[model samples]
Target: MVIKMRLGKTNLEVNKNGFGALPIQRRNMDDSVEILLHAYENGIDFYDTAHFYTDSEAKLGKAFEDVRENIYLASKGAAEEVDEFWKQLETSLKSMKTDYLDLYQFHNISFCPKGDDDLYKAMLEAKEEGLIKHIGITTHKITFAHEAIESGLYETLQYPFSYLSGKQEINLVNKCKEFDVGFIAMKAMGGGLITNSKASYAYMNQFDNVLPIWGIQKLEELNEFLSYDENTILNDELKKAITKDKKELGEDFCRGCGYCMPCPQDINISMCARMSLWIRRFPAEPYLTEEYLEIMENTNECIECYACVDNCPYELDIPRLLKENYEDYQNVLDGKTKV
Candidate 1:
């Protein structure tokens, strides 16, 4: 079965399931190379990595030098300055063992890169120099993604998208299609919040123009997606599963974007705010340990200063959500509820 699509306005045709290279950081170099090779052999040819992701690009470089021309390599840089931008681009090119990238994105920034800025100028010069084929941007904020699409400055917009996404996110995907901007769906599994792979795959299958980058670290996870045929469609069961997840997860759930960090209480707001989801979606043991309990305990120290709430781009009432999750977590510790 052939599952291929054109990424936005880019000429590169790749499988709908792009390999998100973030999770590969957990594995050794040899293991990461093995998984990359296996994914390539099994039909995934689009790879996304970032300068922030430690050694992910280097690992892909090791595995992809031979298949250089055959795959679409996309990478991100966290540079806001002119010099930092060039350094990132050069380092990415050197580490990937390639002279050019299929797409180079501004990673998780609040503002859109404009041609007038030195950073954007760097991208233009890089494209002119054949260092990057197209320019793109990735962000956790929906409004920013929409703004990028409307700006028409980018060839693609990578954003967090999944079955748990609501009407706003769906509209963002539509905007990308309308603007001819490539829509790269990140966190398709909801940052490991979605436990059902088949359901996630089927849900994403509904969007023809959207390309989901599944973070592949394990061969077992890679095989699960590869096992599906090109014509994989959502049926009553899958539809029901997706609907159930959307309903249960709701719009209020923590996405783990970590924008609400550096809490005055020193709480890991990213983890504690979504503690309920963690226990429900993943193994209960890891988060239930004493170490995690202490992390949850820190939630009690929140000064209610609303710092996180003010900073959240999603406009989420983070303090209220954190308090609720902390209560639920404490209940679980008290044996009042089963995870």
Candidate 2:
């Protein structure tokens, strides 16, 4: 049987485990369409995408043209102004090949300003115009998430939720339940840091209302989650493995939220964190090139303006971590270590 969960304030129902379209953007159009159709055929009905995920909306639009009505489509807009918001909403609808959206979210509104009334007003107008069925917001900041629930404007909240999350982070799940707001969990695998799929699935499965969208790029990853229905619960060996992973992961710092993105120095903050994981996990991947070393080393160029530190959801010492990663990346580039 397929797993299903209810999205708040709307009549729409989605698979408890859904597909996240972030990783699939890396693939070609044909490959992306093939993977999306495969997901749809395998009982995945809830698809999440955003305008920022280059060509992701177009790929989904092409793949789901025939079965658009049979699935729920959630898309987000990052526009701050009403005109841009409306433009994005229309673009999203046109790109998704849908007349109306199942859920329209304010993409990554981390720090909502005091007089940001136009954004909410536009969302309401969109709903009235039948452009959207429900309104939602996605944020990495827990404080903003709490405020979203309190604001009563949004029907759902999407954020990071995984076993690595602390009590404060997990508390969002409880708050969503209490507020009757749907909780769509992103980065469930810790952005690929949590290597143990079964343990990750089991941990997420314990929560009834939280839906974790696994960013499945390959058939192997899809099959792994699809296989969990028949698998047993946390065994002793599995517990040991999870414990070992937790210890190695150390204290949760960066959530890979991409808030530190578009660094004025052109440093890719998110990929830098992932590179650290690659060094630890897949040391044999040959894509870690000398050019990649330059990007990592650019972390040393950080002006220490504390922009990333202030914006980080996990409150990580981003400059410090980037410095450490630069050293490690240099070691890997120097043939002293593998990454």
Candidate 3:
């Protein structure tokens, strides 16, 4: 009943359910190790992390240091310079306690790296040195993702994909299949907006080529995905949920991908832009914390530079969105708005 798929030319037969290690950084090392070991003892074999995810790789290293060969370890680096790229590579290798990575990806790139690019050269060198088995790139932009696949410089593509995906996103998946490029799906739950796990699982099941990495923080979340390993079906009820989600999510809302990050004003644009929805959908108490109040107040300092807008793959008017969410957030704080 175990669901496994081959990851394109890399030929990594990984479990359909990949362990996304981003959320584990929030937990203490002991808790993180327990959850990771629980996942490994279950059925997960593909573990994905990134250099930016603080201590996530080290936690995996501690948990699976002795069993490194049994699982596929993939991590990403966001370095731009050649030397920095090497440093990131060495840090990941030492942290994960592995000599070679099953897959090494250029993380969340905005442009398709060309052969002449130094970062691309570094990736080639790493593979040549047997430091990384295969080269891949992750991006949120659809055009650049297509460019990466057509360029034939990468073996895998990790992008935001979920049941809420529109036709263009689905076409990208088909294109990866056509080019024999592996597709690694991130944000499979619409960044915590899609509450229906069965719907997400069923939608991903329709794709034979995708490997969806569910960001697991709690054992309950891990157990939900592991339960889907057997007897998953695209039933009418799940299909109805998918249809409802797509209709409601539309195309303009933020998926909280963090691609529009590091605002010049230090505004939490990623979460602030979607504060209106989060305050309503989730519990309101956490959003009203003193730390969050400061973060939201920083939205006033936006310079209208549009740097975030340019980086955003979805092309959202992030400054404008932040203003709207901030106003609503203020109203909520003043008790004028009902939760």
Candidate 4:
């Protein structure tokens, strides 16, 4: 089983594991360069970054300027207009020191681009200018993905997908396959909620149409994915792990996509909503320590305004879930349950 899959119509054949550069933005330049170079040298050829990721694209520029042609670089444009799109495209090209990108995506837009919009015309003009080889879209919205595939606009769709994601999300991957649209799986580790890499590998390996990009900021994380065999397969034990995760996680948990951010109450709804999983899945001390405890406690400020619920792609009952998780956290802290 060759672990490489050709990404839909663009036909960019990538390993099941691609490098996600969002976390790279948090690292200093030197450390970013080291990890990126290591990833490239070790057979990870697909690199995904975005203009909004702060220094991520710049670090990629420094690390791979000499050999940009050897890798598939995908970046996203957050611009909602024609002029801003061009500006962002130029910034990305200049940052990466590249003339064009293998794929340029509309970053998490609420609606699909259309011929009626200035952005669509700009996309065509950019493709004509050879500034972008392929146009794609990334969104947390499942309905928008269906619309994009139906419109036949995007060559690829990047979305949050992991072992914890349920049937509806998996259908998005399969729908992309049916429509010949590339499926790029983000949040493969469930936004750090899933601690098991081998299980992640086994789960993602089941879909040849889907290519998962692991967000790597540390050496250990990168090494975990890199250490897998080329013929990686999901064994019975891994299947059991997947089933157990789904049962415990249920349907209403946060995927941690951060779309419900900028809470008026200054709360971090993403992590706090999933606090139960973080406590159950990883080391207890790091999260239960004073700093994270403060962050989690801020959910007490939630006014139940439904702002987060509105933005959530899953339409989760966020305020209610936050309260539930907070109550659960208090239990573990009180020695009622072990982490």
Residue clash pairs of candidate 4: none
Residue 21 CA displacement from its true place in model 2, Å:
1.0
Task: Tell me the TM-score of each prediction against the true structure.
Answer: 0.96, 0.92, 0.94, 0.95
Backbone clash pairs for candidate 1 read none
lDDT of 3 at 184: 97
Tell me the deviation in Å of residue 271 in model 4.
2.1
Residue 188's lDDT within candidate 4 is 92
Q: TM-score for candidate 1, please give it.
A: 0.96
For model 4, how does the per-residue alpha-carbon lDDT over 1-339 read when each residue is reduced to its tens digit?
226789999988877779999999999999999999999888899999999999999999999999998999999998997789999999999999999999999999767897677898898789889999998999988888888888888899998998888788988998999999999999998888787899998788888898999999999899989888656678888889888887888877788888998799999888899989887777777788778878878889999989888888889999998899888888888888787
- Which candidate's lDDT is highest? 3
Q: Give per-residue CA lDDT, model 2, range 1-339, as digits (tens).
A: 676777766656787768899888899999889889988888999989998898899999999999988998999999988899889988988988989998988898645523258778888889999998898889888888988888777889998888787788788899898898999999999877788889888787778788888988887888888777524467788778778877877774455678877788777888775566667766545646767767777777888787877777778888778877777777776788764
Error of 4 at 119 (Å): 0.9
lDDT string for model 3 (93-184, tens) is 99999999999999976567889998899899999999999999999888889899999888999999998888899999999999999999
Model 1 lDDT per residue over 91-144, tens place: 999999999999999998757887677888889999999999999999987777
Model 1 lDDT, residue 188, Cα: 93
